[model samples]
Target: MGNNRQTLLLSDSGYDCENKTGEQMLEEAKKNLQSMAFFGLTEYQNYTQKLFLKIFSKNFKLAEEFAQSNRTFAETFINKQNDTVQIPYLEEIKRLNKLDIELYSFAKELFFKRLKDFRIV
Candidate 1:
């Protein structure tokens, strides 16, 4: 008898699609970020940090009181999938104010996504 087998489609997770890494999911997100000029090395990091804070702060309003608002930041937060740990990158987002920090990481992703869309990178 001839062997007949069906192969499964694998997602980015590399296991049939479910293990989206932090960087992966973020890149595939919305595309509405802006571009700012940078000349110094640290300036790049600083820009990402500031933009990131704007993104999350919009999502988590409670943290808004803790950090300066991003003028061109998006006006929405992403719905959670399963509530995995998201505080580590978010916590240090702004300045350890906890709330702002979370927003920072998220907003930063948005910034990158936007940049990617406009081919800013």
Candidate 2:
């Protein structure tokens, strides 16, 4: 006896099959992947913000501003760069508030290290 198998292709809605073509299925897969990636990034960002606040519990506003600025800088500059470079706003924040420079440096290093390790930088 010969083994026979059948594969079923379901539409994105998963209720029925409309006889979609290969290209259509590929496009649907790409859309789903992009959506999943976006969702994961969003969750990661939220977690990072919470972690930052927890680390700098005494200066929530400063931590929030710095996080926001860093996000903007990364999106606008670091993401486009091929070479590793310094983050711009940390020094300004340190000078403005007489913050613990070493602590700030350590936190920044950890953040970038995590990004690099994840290959997101």
Candidate 3:
């Protein structure tokens, strides 16, 4: 089987990317990016949120850095009709950890494998 990269859309009831300004879209994407479901657990979600908030509150620059995740995330969204974008939250974490590309690629593959395994389970 081939690696199919089919992506999904992020649906906002109103004021989404299609109708919103670039700044507004980025703001919304930042907020939406902070979800625990992508981490696959409530604990991970809460912890990451807290850590991000702490950093953001103390140093605004760092918060914006986390928010900058949209750049990589956009690659997936742009291909929503074709390739599947794995969870951006994990990608954000990897970026924050300053892990190299090879490590991140492995992390991505692991996420796909887990997602596949989840379907089987």
Candidate 4:
């Protein structure tokens, strides 16, 4: 997505990305943990497992294990960081939560489609 679009999404999630620090991002992500369950357990579990596996191939099982250990696995998965690549997993999830249900459903569909394109699920 373009930077402007991303910024708008962040705004929808109540995150002022232009001014927020890394700590603020992490804090917001933590606060969003409870709300993440709205995704439903089974769907969250499947998505987490598949996404993690797709992103971190050899570490797929690690993701599964982490899910087992963390009851808020979906939130935790969403908060995962890749410092080297600078991927903002948490922020993405936060934006997702802010979207209307129809938009969110479309986003999920795109997500699953990408996974399928990659043969990850």
Please tell me which predicted candidate would have the highest lDDT against the true structure: 4
Q: Give me candidate 3's TM-score against the actual structure.
A: 0.22
lDDT of the candidates, in the order given: 0.36, 0.41, 0.38, 0.48
| Backbone clash count, each prediction separately | 11, 0, 7, 0
Q: Which tens-of-lDDT digit does each residue in 14-114 have in candidate 4?
A: 54466764445444443443234222224556665656566666643662344434356655654574554435754564555443333445446655666
Candidate 1: regions farther than 4 A off: 1-42, 45-96
As for candidate 4, its clashing pairs are none
Per-model TM-score, in order, reads 0.25, 0.23, 0.22, 0.34
How far residue 35's Cα lies from its native spot in candidate 1, in Å, is: 15
For model 4, the superposed segments whose C-alpha errors exceed 4 Å read 1-42, 58-99
The best candidate by TM-score is 4
lDDT of 1 by residue, 1-121 (tens): 0110001111123232245543343333211112333111222554445544455545644433333344322223423422364455444443334322333455556556655654556
Superior by TM-score: candidate 1 or candidate 4: 4
**lDDT head-to-head 1 vs 4, winner:** 4
| Worst-scoring 10-residue span by lDDT in model 3 | 1-10
